[model samples]
Target: MSDERTETVGRSGRLTMRDIARLANVSMPTVSRVLNDSPLVTVETRTRVLEVAQAHGYAVNRNAKKLRQARTGTVAVMLDFASHRHGAIGDPFIFELLAGVSEALSIRNQELLLSPPGLDDTRAFEDFHRARGADGFIILGQGTRDAMLRSLARRGIPMVVWGAVSKDAGYCAVGSDNLLGGRLAGEYFRMRGRRRWLFLGDIRHAELRLRYEGLCQEAAEDKEVTVEYLPIASMAFNATGQTVSAYLAGGAQPDALFAFSDTAAMAAIGAFRERGLIAPDDYSLVGYNNIPPAANFSPALTTIDQKTDVAGALLVEKLMQHIDGGRARSILLPTQMVVRET
Candidate 1:
């Protein structure tokens, strides 16, 4: 470590591995090894090289490194924008899931590329993979694209979905036990002596279907209980609100209601209030996906907890397993009821 080497860096006004090597009195290869955190480098040499590089503010070009390694070192996170009336970006649950995945990727020193919506088809997935856009993908929702996802899996595409798990699904998935979540809500309503029940949310999607089925199953246990449902295509606030408002205007009276999502439940609540109806007193309501706003809602929502905190780690782990030529199995997390004002 001589002053001459420091002067050389000042003269060039740019830092490089070669400069770091010279300053550390080591070969360029040694500097590269140390910078890459290769275990082959001795502790003393690694420390000296790192100190020199840190002192000069030298940083490795990750893009060049990834290119040389022939791997993008990035994961593309895709969401089904069309499924939601306001797009997936408008959903708070989507943001929560993204934050989890982003944190998990950061821990592994990998980049997260948020893919735009409408990349739901297999060919689009293939093209993106072939173009070296990312090493793999993490889909946010299955949304009736199970067939397309199966095709991608058959073609050896590396992907993992965050949604309901299907028995015949070819790809890996990480999701909650939606059926149990619905049953819990149903049981709670029954205990509260709510006989007339109404369910909201489109069952065309596999996850929502399971929840509806579970609620129905629980309701069937009591002959006096009657369950009805309204098919809602979009989870957008305005769309759900309008749909619920119209249903209420039609004189649809139900003592209990269960929504597939907290957002939908909130929208329904707004609709009910517009018609001079309220929860608990008028109807015992339950919602799914205990999102952040659920607890702080005017009458704090009673919803299901889907364990989103560890979902990202599991999704990233499973996707990496697929990328590494390993077969990763789908995981179904346990769901629980979070009782609140609603």
Candidate 2:
């Protein structure tokens, strides 16, 4: 960008970075490089830029300084879900994930930047890169952005995703063993003398699909056990309630229930109550991602812990490796069941 425009843009009798650039007869970026102490600026140019700034009593904006350094000391967390469709954007899982990521970043004096949920991957990543908003990114899911992510990776963008690990993904990923989590829920139900099982969550997601496969594999071992899959048509509580109500209305009955998330589990429970059924009495229940309020539910949720703490730490560590120009490997942390009243 040209610095000559400073004379026209600057406020009367006040000095801006643009004015300093104009005085030093250099590009605005050169002045920024000098202020940020980047080695890219020649010693003579740096001296001229500093002299102009000192003569004009101009102060640098902290954010501008960081941008010039090319390392914002910030990591952007992008949610790759259709929040409007799910209506679960504010779900406990999102908040818990943010908390874990924030805590981990804070430990290293890095900041967290939350991108708007459901943003178009290509556009979002391009804008973030052009603005230099963050040093790297941690994508929450692989949704429909796999192709875009792969494309970006081919161009050397630093990123880490949280979801199923796949050889074709071509991007660093960190997530819990979703297959093992599903198996644990199934094994626990079978041990409790339950036969019929209903699996919840949208299987279109790569992670949920893997979990569904594992659950079915475990159910196959027991001839008497039957497993049915149900995709959550919507993420609204009432939507889940409506689905449960319809299932009950059709004379369908499952002895065990496994909702992919605690929010869905709670919604299912509410639907059961409307039909005069209680959990662990009429049917056993299991949820995934043991968020904080899971223990306070009426029946206290029996859910699987996705280990958000470890996921968060691994995401940050992996992104750092990529930022330092090193290859980052995917990780699959083990999941464990946290048994409660249900």
Candidate 1 regions exceeding 4 Å error are: 1-3, 6-23, 50-59, 86-88, 116-118
Using lDDT as the measure, the top candidate is 1
Measured with C-alpha atoms, the lDDT of residue 214 in candidate 1 is: 95
Q: C-alpha displacement of 338 in model 2, angstroms? A: 1.1
Using TM-score, give the best candidate's number.
1
Give the clashing residue pairs of candidate 2, or none.
Answer: none
For residues 244-318, what per-residue lDDT tens digits would candidate 2 score against the true structure? Answer: 878877887888999978888998998888888899899999998899899999999999998886777888889
Show model 2 residue runs off by greater than 4 Å: 1-59, 81-88, 116-119
Which 10-residue span in candidate 2 carries the lowest summed lDDT?
Answer: 2-11
Candidates' C-alpha lDDT? 0.89, 0.82
lDDT of 1 at 53: 87
Tens digits of per-residue lDDT for model 1, 1-342:
567546667456898877887889999999989978899999999999999988887878987887787678899998877687656447698889999999999999899999754475789889989878899999998887778888998999999999998779888989999999889999999999999999998888889999999999999999999999898778777898899999989999998999988988999999999988988788989998899999999789999999999999999999999999899999999789999988
